[model samples]
Target: MVLRKLFRRQAEPDVQIEKGLEKTRKGVFLEITRLFDRSEIDDELFEDLEMLLIQADVGWDVSQRLVKELQDRIAAERIVNPADAREVLRLEMIQLLELATRNRKVKILQRGVPFVILVTGVNGTGKTTSIAKLAQYHQGFGRTVMLAAGDTFRAAAIDQLKVWGERLDCPVIAHQQGADPGAVVFDAMVAAHNRNVDVLIVDTAGRLHTKHNLMAELHKLRKIMQKHVPEAPQEVILVIDATTGQNGLVQANEFSKSVEITDIMISKLDSTARGGIAFSVAKELGTPISYIGTGERATDMAEFRPDTYVDSLFFGEGEGF
Candidate 1:
């Protein structure tokens, strides 16, 4: 109960989440909200709700399970009004997210040693931009941050991190393009210690997930980091583009096989109409989503709260609690 109240207050008027979900709320979810306008709940209601959930890119199995659970709840509670049914649906969705995230709290920044984060994803997943946003986020809390340009496969990737580091006034450690990423990680660990940086965000190559050699390289980077900080690379965060829908799940699974993915950060949420990918991610991936990229700006990032995320899909700012 206390947890619910705390989140309720935090989510009340979160404009970032509201605006991020505008496209989704105004899209298929608008059709979903209208489903409750009818006076009665019937078989057709369940069927349509299930269909719309699948259309919204919630996974097939998850959509079926959600509808089934909702039907059982309405039956047990003797629900008749559509408004009441809608409320039931909302609670059910929240429960799904809560179950997935029950014990997977976001990692807290440890004192003393640099909190190294190893970020990975496929090309075009906005991996670099998410790293920038995360750095700025920690800086908001007055934590000093540094960036490691470990994605040396592409010169552009190195340059991108340098640009963000410059823009945020954070120092970046980098070697030349096509340089060994292990060397980059080793130097970054040394640099982080020398500077006493609170957080070190390391960027990794976004080579295609199917490449066995790429996965091998990630393992090598992890070994290099451990030699420096013992528990270095404290977190392996996988960035999944929300616009990829179910395909993002595939990426997460593939990366998890290579490295222990501690958390997920969904990017491009504002650009996708199918925000339901969050639901699928929560239900399918055991790893909790730690953050989300709401927009293009460095400030357009927020900790992933299920209540704030789900409510944003149905309500605009100041609406629907």
Candidate 2:
């Protein structure tokens, strides 16, 4: 059986998310959608569903749990039709994401207080670009945003951030390369505080997750942020490359070991066919995805909503899954 294509209209936000997930919807998830086109659910259906989910980069544990939940729901609800079973599966997936994100409160920037966001990730994960996108997001809210070049290990990192600052017309606080990162953070905190910047996004040097010393620097930066705002560094956003699939999960796991990751931003989402990393991150890491880098352009970003994300993965361009 094949998935059905129908003509329908989608909301603007849903349309953007659907376009961004086009690769994934046409990839492994396409197979999963076809699996539900059958007349009845069976053991073979469950097996194929579980395998397709894992192939999509949903972690092994999360895939198993989803399948088990589907089975239990089918039995308890006496669901025999494949279409009905598929709806149950959708609810389960949405519930998984909603549960993971339920505890988060909306971020509000108080007057005279700076909302600090510390971004971290391994090299080549698009951490700097994600920071730029985040700054643009805050700027959209009519809030003044400042950037801090906390990654003092590389001169190029500092220069790159300054370039972005110029493009955004936002101020960037930095020091000479190889200068103390703590000092940079301290100065940024002071500058943001005195300037009454509504939002402050700090960029850290990209390092392998296994590097202990580099991870320790994150702890020191958090301390510097605390000195200015009693509970500053309010958001620690981790950027992960979607194309890395399961390897991205490993990076998140290792980074979480060092500091509290308040949110996640999956970069290069449009480039990956396997978009299931969002599920694994939400399920395994217990971190809510705040934003997704939908495309290469700095403005090509979308605030992640669980319902929109799940729906886009299976349905798009009037296709019914």
Candidate 3:
């Protein structure tokens, strides 16, 4: 119960969450609200709801399942007025999200010998910023953080992480650009062990999920980490750009095959109106979104709490506790 309350307490204010979801609410839920305002429950109303979900990037399969579930729920509850279906809709969405977030508490800074997170994603998914935010999130709890710039393929990637390391005042391990990434990880393990770091986040080069060679290389990097410290990488986090919509889902699916992605992080959610993609990815890919990038700053990231997220998305500003 204490852990549960602590989890709930860490939830950002309804205003903040709602603001982050503004585009999605206005772009999708508002239309859904208007559909609920109609007096009759007709074929048009169902079709419109289906279209709304798809337009919000909820994907076809999850949308169809949600609509069918809502229909069954309304019928079973003997809900007469279509306007009353708003509550039913809310309940059904909660259920759908719960399917993914159930028994899933986002882990951070657990007491251990340097919990490691391998951050990976394709190019332009805000992987570096997400790592900084993740470090900041754990630092808030007084965890000692270190970063390993294993993205040796790009000098810019190494330089960017070094910048964040300086800003965070955390040590970063890196070598010359074009150096072996696995070699960097090997040395990072030594630094982490010597410094007794609480958390070690490894940054890897961006690669297209379709590229078999790069995927095989990622597997090799993981094996290297495991060799040094058995169970070194406790979490494999795949950073995804929320604005990419259904395409993000494809990346998650493909990336999971190469690396055992333990969690998903959706970045730049504030830039998109189709945040419903969060649902489709979670349902179809079967990986929980551990965090969401709400804005540009380090503090803009928030844990993806399903309950408050659903409430904030449906209701405009602040949701009921």
Candidate 4:
């Protein structure tokens, strides 16, 4: 699908996000030419090109391998034109991203059991807002959905989810401040089951990915859910901020060790210049990104589609995927 269609009639274009991409693309294009424009493709040029990619946060190993592959392809084809070289480089980068963009759709909810999705991330990563948007998405599909404010550590968190519930007209299960998040989740499960809701999304507290104690708390929460429903918490989603760049990957790696992160939801994509990090996360971790939050609006969340994303990044103008 084209990028234009992906966002077609969805809403107004986000001006700030478009401006950010414009600036990022300018830098990326300059880097591409500066690194590849001079002289013939040689060993030294390849090494320099690799360095450029690494500096862009592509990671050292991947950059080296990509440069090698490009050199070999160019050498074997005996390509000489600079424009052709640029196109080839673009295609290769797109192909690398294609690996992660293969499957972008969310998994279908299981029958007879509410699809339970637990959202987690470090504080200030937009976890709460992502949950609200997700609820709106599911509600639009005509699915009966319930939200659980399992981040009982913060009273404001409960109120935040409640606001979303009220806006979407969906039921929300929450507790007082300092309440056990696990207990909240268990209550939510019972409520969802009784109401025969199609989905139950639980919002958890944002903790540092490096915080051992906080990570352990997540483990305990999962164990409690298992006690109530053995196969509960069917989907553990990690909400990542795209602007954090490589640091986002570090968070994903750490969180994956603590909980089985079945999928990812990248937020603030429109506001970040480092959108390529999405490809890096997928390529390095092998976890498919299910959705992306393009803006702050509730309807701005869209299913991740590789073709549309690649087109948007490289072609600069096209329909949505």
Best by the TM-score measure: 1
lDDT of each: 0.86, 0.86, 0.81, 0.73
lDDT per residue, candidate 1, 8-99, as tens digits? Answer: 22222267777878899989888899988897998999999999999888889999999999999999999999999998988889888875
What are the TM-scores, per candidate, against the unseen true structure? 0.93, 0.92, 0.91, 0.82
- For residue 303, what is the lDDT in candidate 1? 83
lDDT of 4 by residue, 1-321 (tens): 345323424332333234324434445534655655666655676667777666555676677777777877888898876556766777787787677656544466766678788899888788989988888777666678899998887788899889878866789999899887878888888888888888899998885345886787788878877775677677788998887878988988888887778778888876765566666776788777777787776667776656555555544544221
Worst 10 residues of 1 by lDDT: 4-13
Judge candidate 3 at residue 135 and give its lDDT: 83
lDDT of model 1, residue 69: 95
Sliding window of 10 residues with minimal summed lDDT for model 3: 2-11
Give the CA lDDT, 0 to 100, for residue 224 in model 4.
71
Candidate 3 is scored at a TM of 0.91
- What C-alpha lDDT does candidate 1 achieve relative to the native structure? 0.86
Q: Which portions of model 1 miss their true places by more than 4 Å?
A: 1-13, 208-210, 318-321
Candidate 1 clashing pairs, residues 3+ apart or interchain: none
Cα RMSD of all models vs. native, in order, equals 5.5, 6.8, 4.7, 5.3
Give the count of colliding residue pairs in each prediction. 0, 0, 0, 10
